[model samples]
Target: MKKGCLIGGIVLLAILSIALGYYFYQQSKTDPVVYEFESPVYQEIIKKTVATGSIKPRKEVQIKP
Candidate 1:
């Protein structure tokens, strides 16, 4: 029984190692990213914003004579 259990553990570990190795191998086979850059073009960008609101003070001050 002990020998059987030891063999089973080793088999499980081997399967896990093989699966991880295959996964990493597949990952490494992926194509590298190739970027295409274009020359800079001059263009006008205009942004206009209008806000309508009244601003008020949070606290009021009192004057004593």
Candidate 2:
């Protein structure tokens, strides 16, 4: 049947695509070229910050009014 042929073709295409993808992935992992550089030393830093008071949530209020 034509439908059966179409289905078979589609399945074959999917299998071939997956196989190619896996082959390329394996190839890349096996013959990989890596280049790394030494990073600069980091210096410790101390930062100071101050925050101004702003409007707060209703739950945070004393509600004495």
Candidate 3:
């Protein structure tokens, strides 16, 4: 009985090891990464600004209850 158990345990371990090895081997067979790039284009940019009137801050404050 002991010998049978030992052989069975060894066979189970061997099967597990082979399964893991095959999984990693398949994982390593994936395709490599690919990258795509485009050239930069030049363009003229115009900026304009117009301002009128004055700005002022509020003068009221309330405390929380």
Ranking by lDDT: 1, 3, 2
**Residue 8's lDDT in candidate 1:** 100
- State the lDDT at 56 in candidate 3: 70
Model 1 off-target regions past 4 Å? 32-65
TM-score of each: 0.46, 0.46, 0.47
Tell me the tens digit of each residue's lDDT in model 1 across 5-51: 99999999999999999999998896889999999999999999998
Root mean square deviation (Cα) for candidate 1: 5.7
Runs with alpha carbons beyond 4 Å of true place in candidate 3: 32-65
Worst 10 residues of 2 by lDDT: 56-65
lDDT of each: 0.96, 0.91, 0.94
**Looking at model 1, which ten-residue stretch has the lowest summed lDDT?**
24-33
lDDT of 3 by residue, 12-34 (tens): 99999999999999988979889
Clashing pairs in 1: none
Q: Judged by TM-score, which candidate is best?
A: 3
Give the Å error, residue 6, model 2: 0.1
> Which TM-score value belongs to model 1?
0.46
